[model samples]
Target: AQSVTQPDIHITVSEGASLELRCNYSYGATPYLFWYVQSPGQGLQLLLKYFSGDTLVQGIKGFEAEFKRSQSSFNLRKPSVHWSDAAEYFCAVGVRRDDKIIFGKGTRLHILP
Candidate 1:
């Protein structure tokens, strides 16, 4: 079985400050990883994904993540955050093609100006 765990349930950061979210996964082999953001009452949008190759992957909205095989972790990082960046973030792990993706409960980000 494959699973993903997001350590932080919620985070608050000041506007223009840096941010990081932690994620850990358990899988048999290299699995498809993705980070998504959802605004209030809105659907999720893909921030980034790691299918294969490169350990470090970049995504939209000034977000980036590094895949560490040894640590079984893929952490999201942003140099600076904006008020608009405040949203719910979810980390997912995709197994088989026909298998359903699993999403973490999500971390609510609050930005203070």
Candidate 2:
């Protein structure tokens, strides 16, 4: 069985500050990893993924993550934050041969100007 856990349920950051969200997964084999961001009343958009090479992967909206095999972690990071970036972020694991993906409960990010 494969599963993902997001430690932080919610986070608040000031504008132009750095941000990081934690993620941990349990899988028998190397699984397809993904991070998605969803705005209120909107569908989820893929931020990034880790399927093969390069432990460090970059994604849209100036976001990046590092895949740590030993720690079973893939944490999201951004140098500076923006007010518009406020949204709910979800971490997901794609199981091989499985059409569906499992998503974390999500972390609601609040931005303060």
Candidate 3:
């Protein structure tokens, strides 16, 4: 079974400020982890993915995430955020072999000027 947990329901950050969103997952020994962002009424956009190799992976929009196997966590980070970056973020885990995908509850981001 694959599962993800996003503890933060909402997060507020000022424009140009740094942002970090936490994610934890429970899955097989080696699971495919991904981070996605979605705007209101829009579909989810892939932010980053961790399949193998690098523990730290970079994504679009100045965002990055590090996979910590010990903590079972993959936290997203941005050095500086823009107003347009405000959106709902979700953490997901997938099994390529089974074509199964599991998503988190999601965390809505609010930009405060």
Candidate 4:
């Protein structure tokens, strides 16, 4: 089975500061990684995903993630975060598109003024 872990349960960043959220996965083979954001009372929104091709993938809302095979990590980063970026971030891993995706516990992002 595949699993994902988000080390940080909560993260706080200034309104315009850079942000990085750690994500690690445990899988025997190359697995698909996805980053999703959920605002308060909102549904999950796909931020970025890593399946194949480039290791570094860009996502919506000025977010990007780098897939490190050796480290089994797919960390998400943003140059400058906005107040609206505050939400719950999730890391998911799956073997195939049709397979069930396993999500992390989720990390709550806090925006500080």
- The lDDT for every candidate, in the order shown, is 0.93, 0.94, 0.94, 0.94
lDDT of 3 by residue, 1-113 (tens): 67899999999999999999999999877888999999999999999999999999999989999999999999999999999999999999997878987999999999998
lDDT of candidate 4 over 78-109, digit per residue (tens): 99999999999999998674688899999999
lDDT of 1 by residue, 1-113 (tens): 78899999999999999999999999888889999999999999999999999999999989999999999998999999999999999999988765778888889999999
Candidate 1 regions with alpha-carbon error over 4 angstroms: none
lDDT of 1 at 96: 71
Tell me which residue pairs clash in candidate 3.
none
RMSD of each: 1.0, 0.7, 0.8, 1.1
lDDT of 1: 0.93
TM-score of 3: 0.96
Better of 1 and 4 by lDDT: 4
Give the Å error, residue 110, model 3: 0.5
Runs off by more than 4 Å, candidate 3: none
Residue 58 error, candidate 2, Å: 0.4
Report the number of backbone clashes for model 3: 0
Residue 20 error for model 3, in Å? 0.6
Please give, for residues 1-113, the per-residue lDDT of candidate 2 as tens digits: 78899999999999999999999998888878999999999999999999999999999999999999999999999999999999999999998877668888889999999
lDDT of 2 at 108: 92
Quote the lDDT for 80 in model 3: 90
User: In every candidate, how many clashes are there?
Assistant: 0, 0, 0, 0
Task: Report the lDDT of model 1 for residue 25.
Answer: 91
